[model samples]
Target: MSQHTLLIEVGTEELPPKALKSLSQAFSQSIVNSLTAQGLDVGAVTSFAAPRRLAVSIAKVPSATPLNEVEMWGPPAHIAFDKDGEPTKAGIAFAQKNGVDINALSVANDGKIDKVFVQIKQGGDAVAALLAPIVEQALAELPIPKRMRWGAKRVEFVRPVHWLVMLHGDQIVDGQVMGLQSGRNSRGHRFHCNEAVPIATADNYAAALEAAYVLADYDARQQRIVSQVEACANQLGGIAQMAPSLLDEVTALVEWPVALAGKFESRFLAVPAEALISSMGEHQKYFHLTDTNGALLPYFITVANLESKDPAQVIDGNERVIRPRLSDAAFFFETDKKVSLESQRERLKNIVFQAKLGTIFDKTERVAKLAKSIAERVNGNAEKAERAGILCKSDLVTNMVGEFDTMQGIAGYYYALNDGEDNEVAQALNEQYLPRFAGDQLPQTQTGTLLALADRLDTLVGIFGIGQQPTGSKDPFALRRASLGVLRLLVEKQLPLDLRELLEAAIAQHAALPAADGLTDTVLQYMLDRFRAWYEDAQIAPEIFMAVSAKDLSQPLDIDNRVKAVQAFAQLPEADALAAANKRVANILAKLDQQPSQGVNTALLKDDAERALAEAITQQKSTIAPLFANSHYTEVLSSLAGMQSTVDTFFDQVMVMADDIAVRNNRLALLAELRALFLDVADISLLVRAKA
Candidate 1:
């Protein structure tokens, strides 16, 4: 078959900026998968996404699909032939169904029976003829949450489908996709070039659009925006603060991006930089500039789609638009400063945190008490923790936060400092919400750490207590994130707090819960289970976590240490045999109707292997006891590795079950002691042998 580049373009109105890149990728992959399934070789697929279109250019695609041979079987020969060996109804029907003469069907004899079969070869269609359906199917599978219909027609998409372009080499692929016939004409920039631009060949699609003032490549356009914005910032002797999400949205908003710098009144800088940045970036889609000291520069960069003849006019218009936004932020800052966080907190009483769980005020009160309790345990100032927790959500009622919801905790920090609260208390008000997402920074101050823990715990226990536990698909309250945040604070921060104890403290704060039965255990298990995913992401083996989890540990830091120790132990040469030996000992003890004796009787020991193992266990126990106490599990396991040989020799030479009942029980007691020593760290028996 001849090889050619195939281009498919779906033109529409502006797509959702955040989803544009994903849509383009999904579209390209779907077509590539379909081509491969058709036995057509395809090469590097280039996907292009913009405000008005999503397109893919596939290189080195074949002109026609390859033939595929399929075999069909018919009824048995005994059923297909009459007594005289003439064709029966079944034989004739099979041939007719296969569109062949009855005599053309061949009989095959097998060990079991004889049957008639036909080998049919299919597929040899021109690749261009199949392009339309493939494109349509790909569009149907796009990850659009909702699709809307344009005009009166029943067809729907993310946006109204305007044109479909399917080009193979220099020829147009003839088919209708999304109710639009295939064409070489694609519309360019809606304002700059309000006309159809003809694509002469599949390879010329990107170049053709660029000439018409549309950069079809998403990455190239994004790069251009970044460069332009940086150059604008550099011209003002400042660095541009470009958030990735905002940059992508701006790239999606423009065709031929022209970044221009606009200035706001420097007086507005009196407001917090985060509030001003939020106003410019979140509301206006502007990139803010920061100075050498990393302070806001009262300037913003905006990407314009069309290149204006008088660029100064565009810059002036943007400046005019941003002035009022800054003014509002300034006003909110001033209005909120007059009210102390203590007074603002009273407003929270009216705000419902959850219908059944009382108001936000109630939550704050509970968190304050829990914070005090947790602070006492974690060596934090209980007074500061309680003070911070009470005012943590107070900013939610502030005017600045009402206007800029992203400034919730941050607004509280500024207000608390203004109110002459302690420095740590002010910092904790902001830090309580730190590490909001994965890989985010955790609270640094002890008071902040305790308050963050107390806040998350209260929500988790209260929510779970009310029978609103998160399911596999839904977690509206973000309990999963909260649970992970709790684990991260405990493990990463090296806090020695126990999750079960904290949950109990939090549960006590609640007056009544509909599903209070086992609430502490349920929430604790759910939070601990979050560690499984966390460790899995770290590439630690599931069995390593399972071995540690088998202990039902409630202390995250301790569990983390044990997990690490087990991981280190699994790498030891003796890990597998010791694990197997432990498994064997466990099975022996489990089958006994009575519990084994607490201590092994030396007089009953007969076998040399049993005596040697008994001596080894006693010595290792004394050596590792201090190590285990200090949480130096790695060293303890390494020390235990020395006893693996004695364990193997004992298991191989000494039978655990003895004919004399007393001797069997004594041997069982010795094995039990060995198992308990290993269990102190982790159930090493669950460790899977590393693959050779």
Candidate 2:
């Protein structure tokens, strides 16, 4: 078998940055799995992705597996032979099908009487023949989240599959996918090098594409974009304040990146720096420049798809296009600032937050009230919470926010401070939306924390009350995020809040609205489910969660403490045995609860085992009661662990189901008490056993 290098390249229109990462990873894995399933040995498989192309290279891949003999079992000896030990019709047919003579047949006493079987040695085919089907299968099965139908057929992909290059050493792997045939041909930069480039092997995959004006590697292309932007900024005596996310987006927008500095009218800088940056980054994919003092400079960097004949003309065209966008931003900024934030609050009365719920203004009022109530409970400053809630949604009506929706909360802080509002009020207005994503920063100030929790709790309660709970990936209201933010605030801020009560208050406030009847329970339950999911994700044991969750999770800090106690208890050496004992006790109680039980009788405890178990329980009750009262769950669980041996001994030596009904009833009651004691920490039976 000869060693060969394999190369496959899929060329298409530019792909979104977020899509490129997932697509490339899927393509790479699919190809590797296909090759392995085909009995080929692949070494050092790698993948490269650009905005317009995805490529895979495999080095030192085997052509095929060597020939090996395989055995085929035939019919039983009795069936193959006749009554006189002569050849029968079945024998003749079997021998003929296997290309052997009937005389070659014989019987051997292995286990049962064995008959003749055929063994054939087969060799592999050419590498190209084996790889073609695998490559085709991988492409057909590649996972693309969003696909489009093109041409006559409804077959969909991220984009139209224009060309495919498949090679094995110096030979082309012949195949077809989606209406296109595989070959050595791949197109370069859509306009820079429109002609096809031929690749003979994986060795030339990258270099060949580079010469054809394609940077196949995504990281290399990103580096080029960054370096060129910096060099351009340096020439203009300013530094580019590049937005990392915008750079990533532009990196995936072009195959060959060329950065050029463009100028906008100086007057546009007078428009708040945020508006200018947002207009440039969000709309135009341009990097804004700032001087040493962090003031906005009148310069921006635009990434061109291709190098132009005259760089000055390209810069001039970009400036003309950008100036109009900045001017519009400036106009909106000036127009929006004329109205005080307080006035904007009044205008928000007409903007609907949800059609069934009410207007944004109504939602803000409820949130303001809720924030004040929560602040009082947590002993935070009530005045600041109320002020923050009122101004939080004011920015939503700003012209700057209308132009850039992502800057809603951020721009509000700047505007609020500019208007001479209290510093805490301005900070809280912005921090109300803190930790918008998983692992993002939570609110830092006490006032901000209180308002943030209230705002999120209000959204969760109102949406869930209207029967609009999130299902699967359909959380349009981001109720899950709001719930998580509430959890983080409670735990991080150590706020002793009752989540159930907060949710109830929010529901009650909304209940006066037209469609909010009977929604309080459903919304509260939804919030609880979110809490359960959050704990589960944090790797908290399910049994601990069930134990703590059985109570109201309204106070997130208390729930966290309970979870910590259970976790510490679970790590003990006798934890599993104790949990089993608790489960056994619970089961006995469950059966006893089906009928009335008489109280425990000391006289019925005739055996020493029963007396010893009863005494141990009596001793543990006093020890556990004080610990549980103090919320020292770790100490309570430790006391319960001491009952394992005594409980086991009683079960081993005493029969709980005695012949006398009274004795049996007494034993069951004792077990019930023991189980009740364990319940103070966790419902240990809910813990899933480890799989082997």
Candidate 3:
């Protein structure tokens, strides 16, 4: 019953920062699953990650697993014994294979009749002995997207394994990984403190490493980096603008983080603040500083991997590396401005977006036409939309954009303004790529919103036209992102644009090819599937989307409104009962339709109950028809629910069929009308049933 703390660390040569967080999470989860599967009582598994190591500590872990018994099945009741009730060879063999005798077996009820079975007694094993191999197996199965082989056996891993620390309580749980053995020792601070540091237990891991000039806890290390960088910038009469993502990357890239301040030539600051900050953050992992007026300062702060004997030496080294990077950025920015924004439009003709499609220029032309068409339909300014579309892709040819690919759209706007282009045109150039990720900003200007939608729609139609649709995880062209972008624009902007017409016109612009290149119904279905996925992600009810989506999805905004109406209706008190009755009507009508029939004969009405149901439906249709035409789905479902009582009464009081064939046909026709009314809202049967 004794419990102990368990610690394991895998040391490696500097791992990619992007892979550290995920790798550590996977390592912790794998260890927890492995320990649980082995019947060990585990508690509080904590993980730590750095560029050189992945470590996990489990507190209050059981020292050994409890013994468990397993049941073994023998032959069937009748087959296990002969007519004289004697055991057969099959039963004896099963007992022997299970390490038991026939006399040890007994009959037990297995929720049916008594059956022949065996209960095997198992003994417990020490948890420490069991965890070594299990932990090794789990590490071997860890999912590291890309792995490499190093040294003699060339065992594969995300990076070459240099050492491993494994301990159970205060004892080393000895094991080997990739030709390296686990011990109580772990290396620290790659340069400043490279000697092996001994660890006693899981509780001592963080403090032990810290004493050796290493900070193993990622969050603590990141906090230190931020505070030091901010303090350094504050001393220079400015504040450091921290990038959370860049901070995370740098945090993972070092064990003993040392924040050092460095200065650059002030002339570099004259080359657009964005270009300067992008170079510093993107290329060097340095945090940029700005004065209170929001102007870039000449100083920046960076984290060093090691604490140097002379701190000034480290600062000078980082400055040397940053100077060339900033100089390259400045050159690209200044040379790019030499060409006017209007002149760059000509260069897009040579940039191929996709081989099957024409140049980037052709895409721009198509998007421009689609944008104007959309603007007119939405009552937006047509001139602004057209102008935005024309200049949106021009930035791809700019020198600064070529050097910093992430600044493609952004760099275009700055250069465009320098060339004296309209503010709207420059703004649209940047806004076209807005909302690149979920919850990111969308286009703020009307023209930019229109152009963004048009550009995405054109991409969806063109790629789908060529049959290069996204399948599973192989979305090479990011079509899924484009689809979500379109959905977000229409729904969030409350734009009154028709998605189906937009797709058709976008496809039509590229439709001068052979029949092999024509747009098929499959392409539109693919786009709708994307819409359904987006709707589900938004937490909307699936039945609502299924119901209204069956009618028309051309107008995405209208589809959204109808979905809201259906969701509200499904939550009503009478929704479930109405859906059940509607489903019954649907089933009966489906069976009747399968048989050949044209019209119902009124003379076949033989019972009062049947006659009453027929009259009720006719009157209800008169009231529901106008409501459906107005898209009052809530009112339509309400009236349909009111018919449930009459439907149930008719089913209970009268038989739908009579000896005469005409009578059955008339009854089926009446039920078909009831089904069609509910179908206008949704196939209500798909709605989830209410709990009693």
Candidate 4:
């Protein structure tokens, strides 16, 4: 068997830019996995993704597939032979079915049964012959949400398939893939070459395409874009603000990238930098430049697909195109200030928030009340928080926010400040929507935090109350994100507010929602589930989360502290022994047919070990109660560890179940109290790792 590099390329007409890289990776990995499963000794794989194509190159792939030995079992030997020790009908039929003579069959016996069997050895085929269908299969399994057909062809793909190339070193594999015949031909950059470029060998694929003005590798192209854009920005004594996603999208848009510097009117900078930057980066895919003081510059960088002979023309064309876009943004900003943000409150009444939850105005009224209530509990100014909540969604009606959807909360901040509202209230308009996605910043001001909490709570409770809970893989309202946002605010902000109290307060504001049992509990559980994932990402132990969550603490910050305290205590040498004792105590309490009395009887105390353990518990109980009250869980957990020796000695000396009914009940009561102490933080019984 000879080893060779295998190349498969599927050419299309401009694949979706955002999905190009991922789709290319999936296609490459799919082919490699399929070949590896077939016992092929394929080597390194390189994937190529450009605007017009997705390709993979595998090195040192064996020319011949490894043989497979298959075993076939037949009828019992007793049934295969006649009474005269001659061939029976069963023996002859089996030989014919296996395509062999009757005498070629053999018999084998196991401990209890005798049977006839045959071993078939299947040989491998050439790599070139095997890859056409493999390439075709990989294309069939691409992660395209929708596929298209071209020119009435029965075949379909992410885009119309134009060409297919399957090469084993210098040899072309012969077959059809996605309606295209196999060949060594691949077209170069759309404007650079416009003609078929022949690939002599699989190893020369990238070099051949590069000569024709294309970067075959996505990462290489992206790095080039970054380097060129930065160099261009530095030339103007400013730094470019190009987001990574923007760079990736730009790389996908061009094959022969040529970064050029262009300038728009400096007057456009009179608009907010965010609006100007949004117009440039989002709508035009241009990289914006910032001056020394971090102020927006008039110049922007654009990546052109071709290096124009008269580069000034390209730059002029880009500048001319951006003038109208900036003018529109300026118009929206200036016109929107004519109306106060407060004036839009009446407009919200006509906008439906949800069919079941009245209108936006009604929801805002509910959020305002909830925010004020929550503010009172957390030392926040109720009036400021309420005012912020009422005006939070008011920007949705403004002309500026309507045109630039990303500017909703931000526009409200500017509008509120213009309307001469309190500085805190103006800031809250923007802060209420902080931390829009994972790892985003949370609200910093007291007013902002309370309003954010109030807004999310109203939506979550109202949505879940109407039985529109998010099912698997479908959260249209982003309930999971809303839930996590609420948790993040509570835990990260160190707010001592009770989650249940907030949920119920928010629920009470919704008169349209039905009064039902478990409404608060359902929304609370849903929010708590988000923490499981959040903590998992932090690499906290699953058992630690289970132990803390089992305690059902209503305050997220308290639960957070307890879990940390428990984690710290588990690191102590005393943890395993105390955890085992707790497990034993739990088992004893679970087996009691009758509920034991809450307190141990002084007269019933019998063993010295039990007496010593009781005294130790009574002493530490005083110290930890105050610590627990202060939410100083770390100190409390450490204080409990001092009683470990007494606990271990009692479990070692006294059996929990005594023959006498009174003694057994009294002992059960003592164990129950011991378990309850630990249960204040977590069910430590769950902390013990089961023995093998």
Candidate 5:
């Protein structure tokens, strides 16, 4: 076998900044997989992603794959031969299909019986002959959500393909890729080199690109951007908070990244820092700098694609462009503050929350009432919560929030503050949307927690009331997020709120026309179902959740407590025996027509084993009843675990179904009492299956 460095480059117009990294990585891995699948020698693959190209280089690859001997299945030996062992036409046809003589086939045991199989040595194709199609397949499989066709060519790609570089050692593995002929010429940075550079060998790809003033490696360019951004921010006596997404996007937009400091008017700082930061980071794609105390600085750092002769001109251009953006933000902020958020409440009537759900103002009214109820139940200020909810979405109509949509809730917070609302009320304006996505921060204040939970509950009930329950991933209204938000607030904040009562309150606030028949239960079940993924991530088995779910535990906080209790109980030494016994009791009860009249009569308790089990239950219930009342599920299970030996002994010694009807009924009642003890926390039968 011979080995050489293999380089593949797909040149294009500037790629999408957000998708460049994923595309490049996918392209590299796709090539590696294709080579490995063909039994070819593959080595460490390094990818290069610049604004204009995606390339991968392999340190070790073979010119051609080695010949392989593989078996080909044929008809069973018994079926292929006659009774005398003479070859039939089927045997000849099988050998002919494999291009082998009938006698060349051998009998091999395929585990169950012998079958006729042929072993053939097949040579591999040359790398040059295979690279073109593999490259084409790799491009065809790129994670491109949308593709465009440029020029008259009947080909589609993420961007227009300009050139390609496919080299094996010093030789060009010639083929057409994405309507471009393969070659060693790759264009450098548009502003720096602006000319095609010839790659002499596959091994010199990075060095050659760097010489042309292009940092082809994605990670190297990303690190360089970070270093420069931090240095510029340091010089300005602030730190640049480089968001990973923004950094990756900027890295994709530049070749030779040179971070330089720029500034806007200091007066713009009076505007909310969120507005200014969004203007710079979202609109201008610049990294904003903040001082040690977390105050916004007027300075920003912008990455230039090229090194300018003056460098000051580059800085001035970026600063000049940012000033207008910041000025617009300042104007929106000032204009928005002229009218208080309270006055904007009337505008919500013109906006629709959902077509059937009524106007936005209607939703706010419902959320206001529901939130106040929740606040009162949780010992928070009802009046303050209602006021905050009333004004929370008012920022949607504000000039500042309309201009900077990402700052909707934040602008409302500042506006509420300027309006002289209470501090918690003002904070709730923003806190309502605290967890905007996965793993985001939750509301820190009691008022915010109430508003977030109320708003989501209202939406869930209103939507599900209209029969728009989320179905099979088509959650256009983000119902899953709303559900998770409610669960998180209840569980993480340890709010002692009951979900059943909350859903009822929210459902009561819905318009009377929708006929919320079982809609409340539907919404609660959906919310509880979201708990499955949460507990699964915690390594709590599905049966544990089922155990808690079987009890109709609606309060997420309580449900979480019970789940933890069940999980802990499952590890007890008596768990398996008790769970199996619980399953047996359940089966026996399910098979009976009547439930053995609820309570065991003392006069009917004739068997000594049944009497002993009954006595143990009465004592354990006295201790566990208090524990279950206080939601001390773990302690209750621990106390009940002590009855396992007594339960097993009763089942072993006492015949539950004696010929006497009264004796059988009493035994049934005893078993029913035992089952109810475990059902206080969870359905132990579900635990049985989980342990299995």
Candidate 6:
């Protein structure tokens, strides 16, 4: 087979900047998958994405797929043929489907029985013939929610298609894609180079685009933008606050990025820095600068799509545009600060949290009570926690927050301080929404922790109470996030809070929940199940989680400690033997009509192995009971690991179902005692030790 480089490009109207990276990568991967599925061999695939294009350049692609001999297995010989070995309807059907004669069918044993098999030589299609349909399928499978039809073409796509480039080596691979004839000509940057840049070969795609003032590689373009922005910020004697999302969007927006520093009025700094940053970044798509002390600077950097002879005009225009945006933010902040945070509570009464759960104001009342209860239990300031909870959602109705939704908690923090509220209360107003996503920071203050847990608990209980719990992926209320947030707060904060107790407390606060049996257990289990994924992501084994889950523990901190302990214990030399011993004991105990009621009688220990095992269990029971109380599960399991040899000897030499009834029952009792020790931490029997 001969190999050649394959180049594919789809030129279109400006693509969405946020979705460009995903679209480009998907296009390249889909093309590679389609080719491989057709038995074509391909090498490294390079993806290119920009405002107006999505493309891929594949190296070492075969011109035509190799011929293949595929085996077609039909029904078993007994079913395909009659008793006299004559062809039946099944055999005739298989022959017709595979385009072979019924007499030519071969019978071979497929392990169990003979089956009719046919060897068909499948011919390969030319690469040129496969390109168009592969590209069409790839485009059709893009993650586009809504597609549009442009002009009178009757064709729908993410955007209007302008041109299609398809090349095999230096020759144009002729085909039609998106109602356009395939060509080697690719359009350049809209302003810098408006002419069509002809690509001579697949290898020259990136160079040709670069010559026409286009940075086709998404990663390279992003790096260029970052370097330019940082340089601009360096000259301004501050650091550029280039958020990842904003950086990617800016990279997708321009082909030739020119970073220029622009200034906003220093007076706007009086507004909350968060609101100012959100205004500039979200509204104008500009990157803000910050001083070394983490204070917002007056300067911002904006990336232009083209390189200009005089960059000062671009900077001046950006400054003019940002002044009004910053002013709007400053105005919203000033207006919101006039009305007290508490006064905003009245407006929330009209806003519904959930139609079945009542208004946002009603939720705050429930959360306020819950926060106070949690604070008392966690040794926090109850009054301050209650105050923070009551005002947590007040920012949702504020002018500043309404204008910038991302500043919901942050705006409340500023307003609470202005209202002369306690410092912790004000901080909790913002911290209530901390850890908004995974790996995000948790609440730092005790009151903040209380309010955060209370808020999530209220939403979870209320939503689940109405039977609107997250089903599959249709989590319109984000109940999964709330559940994970609750677990994270309790576990990562080391609060030692019982989730079942908190759910019960939360359920009591919901006055209007529909009567549903087991609501508390159902929600608690759902939240506990979320730990499986959390542990999986941390690289903990699935069986380790399963062992801990078998105990049906409700306290997250305790469960977390046990999981870590079990993970450590699984690595010990004695773990597999001990786990096996526990499993054997469990199987024996499960068969009994009733477990051994009496403790192991020392008089009935007839075997030396059984006596040694009984003594080991007796000594460890006293030592481990205190460890279990303190939740020192690692120490407990490690101490239990020491009894593995004695356990093995008893199981090896002793007959558990002895002829003497007293001896048999005593042995069962002894085994039960041993299993119970491990059960205090987790059901080690459920553990599957990893093989060396």
Top TM-score hit: 6
Q: TM-score of each candidate?
A: 0.96, 0.82, 0.88, 0.94, 0.92, 0.96
**CA RMSD, predictions in order:** 2.1, 5.0, 3.8, 2.7, 2.8, 2.1
lDDT, candidate 3, 1-692, per-residue tens: 88888898988899889777777888889888878887777888888888788899999887777788989877676667777878888778878998998888787777876678989976477776776676677667777777888767657887888888888788887777667778989887878788999997778998999998889988899999988888898889899998788988999988888888999999998787888888889889999998899989999999998878999988998899999988998898889889977689899999898878788999989998889989999888898888878888888888888888888888888887898877877888888987798778999988889889889888887777777878897999888888778878998898867776787778877845333344645555666677777777878766767767667566666677677777778777777777777767766666663753544556776777777777777888899899888777778877777777787788888776656666776777766766666776677765643322
If both were scored by TM-score, which would come out higher, candidate 2 or candidate 3? 3
RMSD of 5: 2.8
How close to the true structure is residue 91 of candidate 5, measured as C-alpha lDDT? 89
Which model scores highest in lDDT?
A: 6
Estimate, for each residue in 372-457, the C-alpha lDDT of model 1 and write its tens digit.
Answer: 99988977799999998888899999889889999988988899989999999998988988779999999888888888898999
In candidate 2, what are the lDDT values of residues 366-391, reduced to their tens digit?
A: 88888988888878889889888888
Q: Order of candidates by lDDT, top first?
A: 6, 1, 5, 4, 3, 2
Poorest lDDT segment (10 consecutive residues) of candidate 5: 511-520
- 95: Cα error in model 4, Å: 7.7
Clashes of 3: 1
Write one digit per residue (lDDT tens) for candidate 4, span 1-692. Answer: 78889999888899899898889999999999888877897889999999999999999988888888876778888898877868789888988888878877788885579888777666597666777788888888888899888898998888888988889889998888877899999999888798898999999999999999889898899889999999999899899998878888898999988999999888888787888888888899999999888899999999999878999999999999999999999998888888898898889999999998888999889999999999999878999999998898899998877878888788899889889999899888888886799999998788988888999999899999898999999999999999999999998998988999999898888775664469999999989888889888987777788889998878899888988898888888888899888988888778778778898886888999999887877878898999988889889889888889999899889987889989988888888888888998888788885221
Worst 10 residues of 4 by lDDT: 683-692
Every candidate's lDDT? 0.91, 0.79, 0.81, 0.88, 0.90, 0.92
For candidate 6, lDDT tens digit of each residue in 1-692? 77989999999999999999999989999999999998887888899999999999999988888888899999999889999999999999999999999988999999998999999888577888998999999999999999999999987899999999999999899998889999999999899999999999999999999999999999999999999999999999999999999898999999988888889889999999999999889988999999999999999999999988888988888889888888889889888889998998999999998888889999999999999999888888899988888888999999888889999899989999999999999999889987899999999998998999999999888888888888787998788888888899998899988999999999998775785589889999999999988999999988999999999889999999999999999999999999988998999999999999769899999999999999999999988889888889999999999998899889889999999988999999999999999998999888755432
The superposed Cα distance between candidate 1 and the true structure at residue 616, in angstroms, equals 1.4
Clashes of each: 0, 3, 1, 0, 0, 0
TM-score order of candidates, top first: 6, 1, 4, 5, 3, 2
User: What residue runs in model 2 are displaced by over 4 Å at the alpha carbon?
Assistant: 64-156, 190-194, 224-244, 258-273, 288-324, 511-518, 541-544, 550-554, 593-632, 638-667, 688-692
